[model samples]
Target: MKIKNIILLLCFITGFNTAFANEGWINILNEGGNNKGILCTPAIQKAIEKASKNGGGTIFFPAGNYLTGPITLKSNITIYLDAGSVLKFSENFDDYLPYVEMRYEGIMMKTFSPLLYAKDAENISIKGRGVIDGQGKAWWNEVYRIESAKGPIPETKYQKMWTEQNKGIVYSPYYQRTIDKKFFRPAFFQAQNCKNILIEGVTFQNSPFWTINPVFCENINITGITIFNPHSPNTDGINPSSCKNVHISNCHISVGDDCITIKSGRDEDGRKYGIPTENVTITNCTMLSGHGGVVIGSEMSGGIKKITISNCVFDGTDRGIRIKSARGRGGVVEDIRVDNVVMKNIKEEAFMMNLFYDKNTVEEPVSERTPIFRNIHISNVTGTNVNKAGTVLGISEMPVQNISFSNINIQATEGFTLNTTDNVEFHDAKITTTLGSSFKIENSNNLILDNVASMKPIANTALIKLTDVSNMMISNNFPMFATDVFIEANGAKTKGIFLKNNVFNNVKKVINKGAALNAGAVVE
Candidate 1:
C-alpha cells in the first residue's frame, strides 16, 4: 500500500494526521509539531525518534490538548493515546533538565526527567483512552516548602549547578528534611532497566511523583488504569521497584500514597541491588483513599517474594493488606497470597504484618541487618468498618513466621493482634470486636485456632488472650453470646496451652490462669 502509504491513509481518512506508516502508526501531526496546543516536545520527540529509527512504532496522540516536556522512551515503543487525548504535563521544573538513570524512593539517584521516561529499553507500551496529567499542584508546593524548612535551606532555582548540594532531607524513615535535587519530585510514569512492559487504558492524574513507577523492570502488564492523586504528597498508585513478572489488573486507584506499593530496595542501596520485587499478580483492583490498599515494605531491602493479591476492593482505605519491614531492612518477605478481598471504610490495619518498622530502640544482633517475614497466606477475606482487626507484629530479634488466616472476617474497633509471632493459624476466622481482646497473643509460639470465633466480646475482655504463648491449640468454637474469658493465660511463659473440641455453651470461663499463669498453664 505504498503510494506514500496511500497518502498517509488519506491523511488518516481525512481527519488529517499524515503520519501513518503501516505496521508502525505515528502522527504527532506528522512530526515536527506545527500545532495542537503548543510544546509537543518536538512533536513527541519526533515520534519517538521516528519509531526508534524504523524498527519499532505506534506513536499516535490524535485528539487534542498536549503540552509536554520530558519524554524519552525508545526500543519497540508504543504510545497510542486516542479518545480526546489530553497529555498535559510541564509545570516546568526546568522541563526535567538533563538527568537520567533514575530510581528515587529506592535510592539509586539522578533526578528529574520522568514525565514518561524510559531507560535500558525493550518492548514497551502505553496504550490509552487518554488523559495523563502530572500538573501536581506546583509540584506539591515544592514538597511543602521542603517540609516546612528550618535551618540551612539554600539551593533553589531548581538546584543543578552540577548538583551535589545538600543541607539535609531524609524525610521519614523517621526524620531529617530540607535538601533539594536528590530525590526530586518527577515520576508520573517511569521505567528503568526496562523489559517487556505495558500500561493500558490510562487516566492517570496529578502526579509529580510516584504515579506508576517501575524501576529495574521485567515482564509487566498493567490493565484498565485509572488513578487520581488526591491531596498529592507522594502520590503513589502503582509502584513496582526492583521488579519481576508483574501483572496488575483492572485498576481504579485513589492515591496520595500507597494504593499499590511493593518495593524491594532501600537500605544499603537495598542490599546492594539484590533485585527482588518478585512475581506479582494483583487482580481486579479498586482501592479508594490510599495509604495501603496493597502495600509491602517500608522499603523492603531487595526481598519481597511470590505475591498475589486477588479480587480486590477496598474503600476509604488507610491500610488493608499491608506488610511493612524494618530493622535495617535485611530483606526476606516470603511467599504471600491474599485472596478474594473486600474491605470497607477501613481506617487502619484490616490486615497487617509488621516487622517493627523502626523506632530503632537498639537491641542489635541478628546479623545481615535483620528483616524477615515468612510464608503468608490469607484467604476469602472481608473487613468492615475496621479500625484494627489485624496485626502480627514481629521483632524480638526477628519472628514473624509462617502465617495463615482462612475464610476470615473482621468488623473491628480493635481486635486481633499477635506479637513477636511464630507459626500462626486461624482458620475460619471471625472477629467482631468493639473493644478489647477478641484474640491477642504475645511473644507468640506455634498456635492454631480452628473455627475461631468472636462476635463482640469485650465485657471484661478475653475471648482468647494469652501472653508468652507456647504451642497452643484452641479448637472449633463459637464464643461471645456471653463469653467472659473463654481462655486467658498470661506470661509465666504460658506452657503448652490446650483446649480441644471447644464449644463451651457460651463460655463464661473455660480456663483462666492469668496472674502469671502456672498450674500447668491453661488446659481444659
Candidate 2:
C-alpha cells in the first residue's frame, strides 16, 4: 500500500476524525461521578465503551482527581484531561489483576496490565495539560525490598537467573519469570501493535517502570511531553521497542534511567522475532539527570537502523549517546546519525559504544548471536566537563566498522579510546584532557586522523598512542604546545603508519616507539 493510503487506513481503523466534526464528547463526571474517593475504573470503562460504540469520540475529564485502576484504550479515541485534572492510579496492586501481553526489559511476556494500555488499535491519542501520576513509591519500595532480599549480584545476573527459571514456561531463553505478580510493576503507558498514535502535552511522573513504552508499533508521534521520575529505578523516560516511523520532539525528560532509548528485543526471543526498529527521528529535546541522553541498546537483538538524533541538549547525564550490547545478543545496528548536540557535566564518556556489556569476557567463536555495529556518523558536537571524551570497544571477531566523527570538541579528564575497531576516522576534532593520553588506539585498523589536535599541552603524557594498530594516516594536524611526545606506537603489529604535513612545536620529539623513523612514517 502507498504511504498515504496506509495512513488513511490507520485513521479509519483507529476512528480518527481529523475535522472533529459533529462527534459527541462524553464527560465521565456526567456519566457517573463518584466523588467519594472511590474506584472509578468501572465508570470510566463504561464511558469508553459507549464512546467506542458510538463511532469514537473524546472522553473528557474535567478538573478533578480520578482514582482508577488499569484502563484500556480503543481506536479512534482521544482521552482528554483538562488543566488541574489528574488521573491517579490506585496504589493497590490487586487493582491491576489479570495478565497482559507486554515487553519488560526487552523480553516479551504476560504480566500485569500497564496503567494505560492499548493493543491492536489505530489513530488513538492522549492529549491534555494534565498529570498522570503512577503513585509509584509503593512499587519502588517493593522492588527495592525484593532486591535487598536477593542480595547484590548485579541486576542482569538476577534477571538471567529469573529468565532461566522460567524457561519451561515461557518457552524462550530470554523471558523473565515473574515469581509473583506483585513484584512486577507495569509501565505507565504501553501501546502495542498500533499505528498513528499521538501522545502530547502530558505530564507523567513517578512511573513504576518505563514512563512511556510502545512496542511493535508504527507511525508514533510524541511531542511537548514532560516526564520527571526522580530517584526511581528503571523509570526510563521513553522507550520505543521494535517500532518504526517514530518521531519524538520538544520533550523535556529527567529520569533515573535513560531519557530516550531505542530497542528491538533481547537475546533469544529477539532473534526469534527478528523485528527491527527503524526510521526514528528525535530532535529538539532537553534531557537531564538520566543514565544516557539517547541510548540504542543493551537489549537490541532484533536490530535497529536509520535513526537520526539532532538539535538536542543533555545536561548532567551519566552518558551521552551510548550504544551498548553484549556478545550473546546478535544484532546489526547501522546508519545512525547524530549532529548538533551539546552536552555539559557528563558524568562519563560523552560518546560510548561498548560491545562488551556483560561480565563474561571469554572469547567465543563467531555465530549468529554476534553483535555488529557499523556506519555510525556523529558531527557538530560539543561537550564540557566530561569525564571521558569517548570510547569505542568492539568485539574481536566482528569489529565495529565505518565509524566517523567530524567537527567535534570535548573537554574532559581523559581522551578517546578505541579497541578492536576498524575504519574509524576523526576530522576537525579537538580534545582537551586533564590527564592521560589524548588519543589511545589498540588493535584497530584503517584509522584516519585529519586536522585533529589536543587543546593544551600536558606533561608526562603522549598526545597520541597507538598499539597494535595498522593502516593509519595522521595528516595536517596541529600538535603545537601539546605534549612533548607527539606520537608513540608500541607492539610489533604497528605497521603501515604514515604521518605527513603535521606541525610540531615547543621542543617536542615525535615518534617515541615501534614504527621505524622514515620519510613516509614522519615528516616535520
Candidate 3:
C-alpha cells in the first residue's frame, strides 16, 4: 500500500473523520465574556458539556493565555487550540484537589489529581497548535525531597498532611494505612480506559509527573504531538500502559524521563492483571533528552509483543533503544522490529539489554536470569558519538537468542561486550571504537560474525576476546587493533571455528590452535 493510502487506512481503522467532521470549537472568555487573555475553566467545562449534549464537537481555545483549573473532558469531544494558544494551569495547588482514580509508582493506588482527565469515554481527542503548561515546580521538588530522605515515608500522614497543607485530598485504600505508596500528582493530560481516542498537534510542558498517560485503552492514535517537560521526578512522556492497538507517529518528545514507555503493569499487580499490552507501532518520531528514547518493560510483568518502531531519531538521550526487566518479571517481550534509526550523542549504550536490572535489590547477584528477548531484528542504523555500542546481559539459562543486527554502522566510545550464553548473530555490522576492544565475548557460544568490520581504535584496544565459546564462525572479517586476539575455552565442548577470508591490520595473529578449533577452524 502507498503511504497516503496506508495513512488513510489507519485513519479509517482508527475512526477518524477525514471530511464532514463537525468543527466543534469552544472559546473561554473572561467573566465579562471578552474573547481574549483570560482563563475560564468553568466556562470551558460548561461549553464542553453543552457541546457533548448536542452531539459532541471540538472545544477550541483561541490564541491567547487562558489560565484555568483542572477541566474534565467528556465523551465524543475534541479540544482544539488555535495557533498561539497558551493554556496555563493555575498556580494554586488547591485548584486540583479531592484526588482521582490514578496510578502511582506502578500501583493502581490513587491520590492527588491530574491536570486534565477523561474517564470511560469514547471517541475523545485533544488536538491543536497550542501549549498546556502544568506549573510543576512545587510537586517535583516534593518528590525529590522525599526520595533524598532515604527512609520510607508514611503514606497516610504524608498525603493527609500534604493535602491539609497543600489544600488537596487523599483518595487511596491506603488512606488509612500509615505506610502508603508515594503518590505524586500526574501530568498535563491523563485518560483511563478510553477508546478510539486521538491527541495530535499539541505542545505539553512542565508536567507534574508522567505526561499523556493512556492506560487500559484501545484503538488510540496519537500523532503530531510535541511533549516537552524538563522537570524532575517521573516526568515521562507518552506512557501507554495496558493499551492495545496504539499507533504513535510524527511526534517529538523531549522529557526528563523516558520518551515513550510501554508497561503492562508493575510487579505483582501487573501479573495479576494479566493483560499484555500488544500490537503497538511507533513511527516517524524524534526523541531527545530522555532517559530512554523508546523504552519497554522496566515495569512490564505482563508480557508485551508485536511492536514496530521505525524511522525515528534518538538524540542526546541516555539510551537510544532500551529493554530493561528485572528478575521477578515473568513476562516475555518478543517479536519486535526496529529499523532505520539514526542516533547521535547517546550518553549511554546505543542498544542495551539488561535482564538483570536494579542490582541494588538482588543481594546475592543473580547469575541465572530470564525474560527472553529473541527474534528481534534491528537494521539500517547509523550512530555517532555513542558512549557504548552494545551491552547484552542475558540469562545464564536462556541466553538472548535469534537476535540479528544487520547493516549497522556505529562509532562509539566502547565496543560490543557480550556476557552469558548466546546464539547471537552479527551480520553486515561495522563498529569503530574510541576506547575499548572491538568485541569481548565471555561464556557465550554458537556465535556467527559474518562480514563484520572493526576500525582501529586510537586507544590501546584488543580486536576480539573469546573465552569459553564453542561452535563459532568468524568468516569474512576485517579488523584493526593494537593487539592480538584472545580465545580461551575452558572444559566446554568444542565446535568448529572458521576464520576464512579475514583481514587484520596493526598487530593481530591467529592463536586458536586448540581442539575446539577443530573443523573448518582455519585462519588464512
Point out where model 3 deviates above 4 Å. 1-24, 30-39, 150-158, 161-181, 360-370, 457-460, 480-496, 500-507, 512-524
Q: How do these models rank on lDDT, best leading?
A: 2, 1, 3
The digit string of per-residue lDDT tens for model 1 on 1-524 reads 58999998887786543333355787787786533667778778878888899898888888888888888888899998888888888887888886665777776666677899888899989998988888889989877876677865776755643255332322334422323333377788888889999999989889987999898899999999899999888899999998999999999999888899999778777778789999999999999998889999878888989999999999988988899888877889999999999999989888888888776646589976788999999999988898997988888878899999998888888888899898999998888888887788888998898887776666767777888889888887766488777777788887888778877888777776768777876676
Query: What Cα-based lDDT does every candidate model obtain?
Result: 0.83, 0.86, 0.75
Tens digits of lDDT, candidate 2, 1-524 = 69999999988966756435535788888888453557799998899899999888888888878888999999988988889888889998778766677888777776668999999999888999988899999889878776666544444333454444445433233222334322467999999999999999989999999998999999999999999999999999999999999999999999989999999998887888889999999999999989999999988899999999999999999999999988888889999999999999999999999998875655789887898899999999999999999999998888889999999999999999999999999999998899888799999999999988788857767888888888999988876664588788887777788888777765377778764433344333
Best by lDDT: 2
- For all candidates, the clash counts are 0, 2, 4
Model 3 C-alpha lDDT versus the unseen true structure: 0.75
In candidate 3, position 256 carries an lDDT of: 91
TM-score of 1: 0.39
Note the residue pairs that clash in candidate 2: 14-76, 14-122
Distance (Å) between predicted and true CA of 80, model 3?
A: 0.6
What's model 2's overall lDDT?
Answer: 0.86
Error (Å) of candidate 2 at residue 131 is: 0.9
Please give me the total number of clashing residue pairs in predicted model 1. Answer: 0
Give the per-residue lDDT of model 3 (tens digit) for 244-297.
999999999999999998887766667767677889999999998899999987
Best-performing candidate as measured by TM-score? 2
TM-score (all chains, Cα) for each model: 0.39, 0.90, 0.84
By the lDDT metric, which is better: model 1 or model 2?
A: 2
